[model samples]
Every structure is written in structure tokens, then in C-alpha cells.
Target chain A: MPEQTDRTENPEHTLVEVRGFRMAYGATTVIDRLDFEVVRGETFGLLGSNGSGKTTTLRALLGLIVPTAGELTIGGEPYRPGRVRVGYLPEERGLYKREPVLEVMTYFGRLKGMTAGDADRWSRSWLERMGLADKARLALGKLSGGQQQKVQLGVTIMDDPELLILDEPTKGFDPVNQRLLMDIIAEQQRRGTTLVLVSHDMAQVERLADRVLLLKDGVARAYGSVADVRGEFGGKSLNEVFLEVYGTVGLEEDAA
Target chain B: MSAFGIVLRFEVARALRKKAFWIGALALPVIIGVIGLVQFLGAQSAQQAAEEQAKAGFEFVYLDASGVVDARLATELGGAPAADADSAIAQVRSGETEAFFDFPADPSTQPVTIAGRHVGVIDDGRYGAVATTLLAESAKTEIGSPELVAIVAGGVRTDVTTYLPDGSVSTAAQSLPVGILLLALLFLTVVLLGQQVLIVTTEEKENRVAEILLTTTRPNAVIAAKLVALAIAGVVQMLVVFVPVAIGWALFGGGLSIAGLDLSQVVFDPQQILLGVLILLGAAALFIVTLAAVGASAPSAKEAGGFSALSIILPLAPLYAAAIIVTQPSLPIVRVLTYFPFTAGTTSLLRNAFGTLPLVEGLLVAAILFVSAALVLRIAVRAFRRGALEYDRMLGWRDLLGRPAR
Candidate 1:
């Protein structure tokens, strides 16, 4: 166990520190000694090509998977395999299809140690904020996909986790819902919650992320502030920068 | 709240919300009730019809080839006596009588033939006595010497000895079948209910809802909640089957009028019932564990079905094998199965019902099953944790059997 540090002293304080992390599934090395940190009160974007290990890295950080080798600490404490104080939204979309919105949210909230009353109150507020108040009592399967994603977000925040790891939180959202999701992320940032956003949408990443890490071939190829990485690639957009580093290699392999 | 508590609460809420759970838990009982009611009505009507047919006097006839007994024997037999032997035989041949008996004229012969109209009649020892009595009486009228009469009476007495043990022995053996039938019912109930638990676990896992649940809660908690919910459902199902049959039996003249009913002995004692429930819980726990492990290991619901079939067949095999094993509890196959967790729960419970299970042996069997259940829960939790974390890799047997070296 370690003490929580004051965020004011270090604005770029490492809320989540991953050093030399490596993970492999039998013969396939998914993450190779990847080093990065999510600063306090900042939204960090994890950018990667299709097999770039973004999801793997997020899963490792959440203590869902024990890394083959590395050290991971959240808020100055080593991650306990089953007791990490974190909230994770897997890239694969899932919810108990038969559960109503309010019940599902409260259930996930309780898992994070929230009292029933508090969980219920906060879940209601979140549902209302996400424009799901009308469908609170409806089973999750009955809600539209985007609406279900909103409930997924609601589940993540109901416990007010110190670290929120969302893997493509805005994958299927319309622009309006996307904006709503971004606003929610922004609100979480305002509350000093450290967020790890994994997305392929470069524009969204550039706008929200304080820092960006580009993973290619199971290794970090670029790591720095969004602007610095952008400038290093000849002042191109983040997507262009991504293309420059990964596009040719992927294309050549595809062609061959 | 503790982590486990949170997981338990969440799982309960999630399971309760599922329409399938409700349908399985609540709706199944209603269906069982309907089925039971139909069967009960059908049985009642059949019984009533049989009773009506029996009351309509069945004509009975017999051939007295011994010739010593005449039409007077028919009068003594306590039915509408025929005018003569010819008429009695004719009635039986015409199907006016339900049955008729014929006695051999030669009473001193061995294996004397006694014939019936519809079937062969083997000597039941009682008929031999009756024939001897009629022959002795006729001989007494023909031979009028006191000394000869005493000699004949002495020989007849020697032939018929009162060696049969009073009544209790026969009564006990007569009630054995009822005990066996109850044991069979218990085994059947356990197998059916236990399978339901397995199917539910596999279905949820296949649908990926279990993954969502595992992510939010501990696997042990999920297993616990499922066991509790499913056990209640199972008990309700048992009641739905047992209660009506019991009420029907009682209402149908309180076990007296029913010729086949045997109530002279205790079929199920309190300890036996408690043990049966305990065994059921152990069986259900084992079911949840194996199914959860299978579900977690499978990549998709479709793949789960293949693995799930093993769980279904394993428990049921022992249940179907119970009848043969109940008779020979110490058989090597039965003994080995009684120690195994899944099979033991159903088989040993039934064995206990039949009084074949010694108290020490029963407790030991129960202990082994409980420990197996705990081990299963542990494995299930590990599988769930690993499965939840590794989303890209389809969960496989390798995850449980061979974890990555580090």
C-alpha cells in the first residue's frame, strides 16, 4: 500500500504507472514492455492499429489480466489482481439483457462498494443525465444500442472510481450521443478522475487526451503530449501521424 | 458491504430480472401442477371404473374331479352356487364367470393337476390342505373303526404343521417395494432439478451474460445466488409433484380402500429427508461449479452446449443406476460411485432412503461431496476471473488446466 499524493504539487502526476509491461498469449506477444502513465485529472488516449494491443493494455491496467512481466501501480499502490479500485468498460458490448437500467447500474455500483441508497440515487442522476430516465425500468435489451452504451457509462461512474478505463466508449454513438459521452468524460475529468480512453477516432482523442501513446507491433512507437506527437509528424493530424507510422507497414504486409 | 456480499446482491438482482429465471422458477411449478392434476384425474377415473366393474358379481366355477366334494362345495365357496358341475363349467367357458378352479380326483398323488379356465393353477399349498380335509372326511364315513380313524387323523396332523412365523415378517417384506418406489421418486426429482441448474448456468454463459456478471461481481457470489434460487425452485417443483399425489391418496379413502397402497412402515424419516436435501444442495453446487467452469471455458454458447451435455449425463446416469445399486450397495461399481461427488449425492441419498446406508458411511459420503463442492466453487471462481480478463482469447480448457507459465 502507498499514500495518495496531492494532485496540486504535480499537475502531470502519474495516477496510473505501467513500466516495462509485457503480455503474451502462448506464442503471440500482445503487449511488449509498454511504458506509460495516466496523469491525475487528465484523459489519456491509447491509440493503436487493429492488433496494436490497446484493449490488452487497458485490460492489464485494470488488473483483469496479470502481465507476463512488469509493474503496474494506481495512485501509488501496486495493482492487486482482484481488488484494484478501478472501473472498466470492455470493448465488447455486453449487459444483462434481462436486467432493467436502474437495477443493472445499481448492481455494478454495489460491486464497487457503494451503499444501496447512494447507488440508487447516483444511478438515477446518471440515467437522467444520459436522457435514459424514461427507460429506467425497461430491460437493457429493450434499449437501443446507443442507449445501452449510455447505461454502460453510467455503470462505470456510479461507484465514482478513481480510475475509469473505457475501451472505445463512443464506438456506436451518434454525434449527439458522442457529444453527450464526451461531456460526461469532461465532467469526470473535472472531478479529478483519471481516465484512460482507448479509441481509433483520432479527432476525439486529440480533443480529449492530454497525452497520447501510439502502440504498434506490441511496442510503443510514439509517446508524448498530443501536440508534441502531432508536431513531430510534420504538423499532421493524429490520423495522418498514425498512417505515417503504421500505414505503410500494414499496407506492405497486406500487399505481400 | 463486503466484496462477496456485493457480488451476491448483484447476482441475485441480475438473476431475478431474467425472464428465463422467473419462467424456470415460477412457471415450471405451474406446468408441473397441471401435468400432475391431469394424471391424478385420469388415475381417479380409472380406479372408479375398476371398482364399479368389480362390484358387478363375477360368476366363478370350479371342477371337483375328486368327486368326494359335490355341489355343496360350491355353496361353501360363498358365491351364487351353480345347479351342478356341468352348469358351473359351462358358465366359466361362456365368460359369464371371471374365473374357475378344478381339483384333481386323486388326492394322494404328487404334483396333482389343478386347472383354471383362463390359466394354469399351481398348487398354493392351501388347496392341498383343503383336498386332504375333504378326502379325510369322506374316508371317515366309509371306514367306521375308532382305531383306524385315530391313525388317519394322526397322519393328517403330521402332514400339516404350523411352522409359519406369525405375521410381522410378511408385512415388512410387503412394504419393501413402497420404500424402493419412494427412493426412485427422490432420485428422479434430484436428477431433473439438478439438470435444470446446469442448463441455466450454461445458457447464461453461452449468451455472455455471465461475463457481464463476472466483471461486476465475484464468481463465488454468483454461484451462491444461483444455487439458492435454483434450490428453492427445485423444492417447489418437488412439492408440486408430491403434495397433490399425497392429497389425492388421502382423499381416496385414506389408504385403506386402495389395494396397492402400503403404509405399514416408514418410507422417509426426518433424518433421511434432511440428508436428501443436503445431498440435493451438494449436487446442485457441483452442477453449478461444473457448468460454470464449462461455460467459462467455452468460446461461445454453441460450444458450451457440447460441454454442458457431460454435466447433464453424469448425474443422471447414477440416478438411473440407483435401482440396481440399491439392492447391492456394496458392489464395487456402486461403492465407487457412492464416493464420487456428483453421483454420490443422488445415489447415496437414495441408498439412505432404502436403509442400505450405514450412518458413518452416509456422513463420510456427505462430507466428501461437500468438499468436492467447495473445490468446484474455487475452480469456477478462477475460471470466471481468467475468462473475464481475457476477452480476445476465446476461453478454453487451457485457461483452467494450463495457465501461462508466469
Candidate 2:
């Protein structure tokens, strides 16, 4: 794990802030009073077992759903398109599968506030960079799973959004392509983009995230810098720490 | 472009690119054209056969025992005097002459008899028509005064004008075509465009793209843009079918007039047409928004398919109740159909064309649709937010009623 400095001392550095967020569906509460923050220019890894409210939290943060009780804001205000440029790659992982890759990419680019010409240009460039230039005009469903994921990521980051929220961004990639995706994410980090990555892959999270938050059943189990989290959990790797948090059930679920 | 504009442009482009849309769009017109061509050719063949039959005169003979027969008129009408009824019948049976007509002495008390060669059942009626014309012409000649003959030859002709309670004067004939035209327009615009609206709205949920879309733009704008795009696409499809039909009518319509309708006597009312346009606009908005709501609430496009069919069937329900709409517009059933959002457009169009809809009632019906559309638009937006991430189960009353986490 790379050593990242702790920036919790400064309020101004916070890019994302969630306070007392509670979400309940009918009689059951999925998340209860959850709280966390991500500083600007740092990669924040949001880790959790399956059905542990990682997606729910991100959904609230991006204003995809209305929170039942608390505030989930980006850049100190509620997320709204054109208020801040945001790129979101959801965990469900889909696109307009019947549309051409370039067309789909360009459509999302324009929605993110790019001009048509600029959106087309950016889409083509991203397609080439992802080694999918030849598949640009093919229907998205015709491509392999990993190739489609690449195009989806390209759509998310094409307009250089200030905040990028990627839920399992490398879910379908092979190891080689996964490494390539990490490089691309690293470039975004260098551009000062704040990233909140949700993934089950502990090593990938440990390598990329400056700070990490481990959620279990919607409660924050561990938070702060990567090194601090590891040190607090017996100085073990994040993979070992994740096992401690979720127990053997997590292993069974992940295996399934 | 604004977000709404971008989404609208993209959606329209997507629909236009689908091969199914093009195929569906062109299919109806082609089928109609083929049917019309066949009918036209059939009519032409029948007319040619009739002209040939007329040229080959029916050399029939008549024995007028009443002494009122006009031989000159009978000859001109393709009949000649027969020496006796028995000989004429013999000739007809032997295929020497086409028919024989025997007029009774007391024509009023006893019926005139005719014997004709066997043709088809329908074609045999032409013999009766020819005999009747010959007898009427002979009677007119017996009257001897041209003025009296003119009055006797044709019965009194009367044209009726009705004064409606609303102080408008109209003939029943004037309203029929307008009513038919409006009904046809409603079917073309709503049922056809409705499928497009449902598909566009539900595909995002089926493909799991709604969440990403919600994050990229306001959910309300996304829904609104899709509604607008669908409306525009429907207009395009309507034009694809209507333009050629209208052009064909303009070119060939004079020769192929509706049999009972006299075009010169048909009066087109401007107010009725204008009200019809308003009803159309209101109906389009209401149906599109409602379909959007159905799409958002459904778990998948496949599930939404049932609701799509329901939406289409409901609007056209008024068609099945056409007897009540046309004859009893003041009935409770008509009132219910007129005020309900789904059935309002078709009911209003029917009433407006029939002149049974007052201006106030027409406006009220249109207002109901517009108001319902606005309310449904809000529901659709909220349903989108609630159902955006749900892939397996449909959003029911509980999910829609309960707000989602912010």
C-alpha cells in the first residue's frame, strides 16, 4: 500500500461529505447514520461486502436517490448536473447496447456538457486509447464483456469530469487490461480529479486509494488513510483486514 | 444544446435508426396502396362490362294490355312491341330475345309481369329496373304535358337543415366525414406513436442505463426530453402515412367520391377542426407522459409490454362505444369517457365532429388531459428515481409512495 498523508485535519480539503445519512426501505433500514468524507485530489476506496450499502451510499451521494434523513453532498453542495461535472460508472454495468459505441459515448459526452463536435472528437480519442477504435461503430452488445466495460469507462471519463465515481470499474477486465485501467485512473488522479472507487478487489483498492472506508451493513467499520487502517487492524494487508471485517460469510458470498 | 435538447436529439436519432420503426412506418401505407389499386381495377372492370352490356341492347318486347304503352320510348330504352305475351315468353325461353314484359289491364290493381333469361341472382335485378323505367316513361308520355310529366317522373326532393340547441345550423351529412376523419387521425397518432413512446421509455430501465442517466442530468429533464422526442417522432410517422394519402386523395378523390356523400353539400366547420387540433395536442401529451410513467414503474421492457398494450387499448375504448358517442352524447358513459384522461381525446374528437360538444365542454376536456399530463410527468420523474437501480422487482405502490434516499 502506498503511504498517503492524513488530511482530516482540514475541512477545506474535503471534496465529498456525508453526515448522519440514513436510508430505510419500509420497515427495514439499509443504512443508519453513516458518515465519511473524501478529500480533493485523493483516490477514495469505498469497500464493503455484498449488500453492505456501498452502492446505496454512492447512490445517495450522487443524488440518484433522495436520502431519508441526512445530507450527502459533493463539493459542499448537493450533486446536480452542470453544478459540477460528474462522471458515474454504476455497478449494474450497462449502456444502450443496440447503439454504436461511438454514438453511445458521444451521447453521454454531450449530456456531460460537451459540444457535439468536441464530444465526437473526445469519444473517438477515448476509443483509440482503449484499443477499441475498430469497434466504435459496432453495436455495444456485439463486443466482449470487457470491451463493453472499457467503452463505458471511456464514456464516464471522456469529458474530464471533476469528480468520478466508479463502482467496480475493473469488474470484467483481464489482468493486463486491469493494469491498463489503473494507469488510466492514475492519470485522472494526477489531473486533480477526486475519485470514489467501490470494488471487492482489495489489492486494487490498496494500490490506488489514498484513503479507504470499509462499510459493513451500512456502518463505517474502518476509515482514514490506508496505512492507518492497516495499522489499526494489526498491521495486515487490506485483503486480510477485509476478511476480518466481513468474516467467512464474505468469502462465501465473494466466491459465489 | 441544453441537456433536454441533447437527450431529445439522441432519443429521436435512436428511434429513427431502428429498422423496425422504418418497416412499421412504411408497412401500413404500402398495404393501403395495394388494396386501393385492386379495388380501382375491379371498379374499372365492372364499368367496362356494364358499358358493353348497354351497347348490346336487351331486345325485349312488351304487350301493354292497359293501352298506355309508348312504343317510341320503349324502342329508345331497348325494348320493342311483342305481338302477344305467349310468343314473347317463347322467344325469351328460346334465347331469341332477352326478355318479355306484359302490362296488366288494371296496372294499379294487378302487377306487371316480366320473363327474362336466367342470369345471376344480382344481375336479374337489372331486368326489373329496366322494366320499371320503361313503364314510368310510358306513363309520363300518357300524361302528355311536359310539366306534369316532369313532376310525375321524379318524386319531391327535400333538403333538411337542423337548428341545434347551441344556435348552430348543420346538416347530419356535414358532420359524418369530419367524425370519420378525426377517428382515423386519433388511431394513427396515438396507437402508432404510443408504441414508440413505451419502447423509448422502458429501454433505459431494461438496459440499466437510467441510473447513469440520472447522475448525468436531472431525472425530470430526462423524462421530459424523452416525452418531447417521442411526440416529435410520432408526428414524423404520421406525416409518412398521411402525406401520401392526402396527395392521393387530392389527385384521384374526385373520381372516387364516397357514394352517399355529395361533396357540394358537405360543409366543413373551422371551429370544429380547430377544437379537434387542440384535443389532438392534449391527447398526445397525456398519453406520452402516462406511457413514460408506466415505463419507469416497470421492472423491465418485457414487463412494460403489457402496460403498453393497455395504454393503447384504453384510448381506443371510446371507439367501441361509438354508438353511445354518436347517438347519446349526453349519456353518463359518454361523460365518463370524455373526462377520463386516457379516453378524453377520442371522445372529445367524436363529440366535436358531431357538434355535440360545446366550446366550454371541449375546453374542459382538453384541460383535463393537460392537467393530467402535468401530474403524470411528476409521477414519471419520481418513479424513475425510485426504480432506477431496481433490476429484478417492479416498483409497486409502496415503493412509489415511499420516497427514496437522497
- Per-prediction RMSD in angstroms? 9.1, 5.8
lDDT of 1 by residue, B123-196 (tens): 23333334344445556756778778888777433222222255322222333445455445545454545445
lDDT of each: 0.67, 0.82
lDDT of 2 by residue, B1-406 (tens): 8888888888889878889887878988898889989998999987776555544467788888998878887889788889987899999999999889898998778988989998887567667677766777778877889988767757556777888679877654685677568768778877577667767777887888988888888887888888887777777887898898678767876554566455545566777777788788888788778778888888877788787787788888898998889789999989999998999998988888777888888988888888988888888878877877777877787776665434
Q: What are the runs in model 2 whose C-alpha is more than 4 Å off? A: A1-9, A248-256, B39-172, B249-256, B264-266, B404-406
| Highest lDDT model number | 2
- With a 3 Å backbone cut-off (N, CA, C), the pairs that clash in candidate 2 are A65-B405, A66-B405, A66-B406, A67-B405, A67-B406
lDDT: worst 10-residue window of model 1 chain A: A1-10
- Which prediction has the highest TM-score against the true structure? 2
Alpha-carbon TM-score of each model against the true structure: 0.73, 0.81
Give, for candidate 2 chain A, the lowest lDDT window spanning 10 residues.
A1-10
RMSD of 1: 9.1
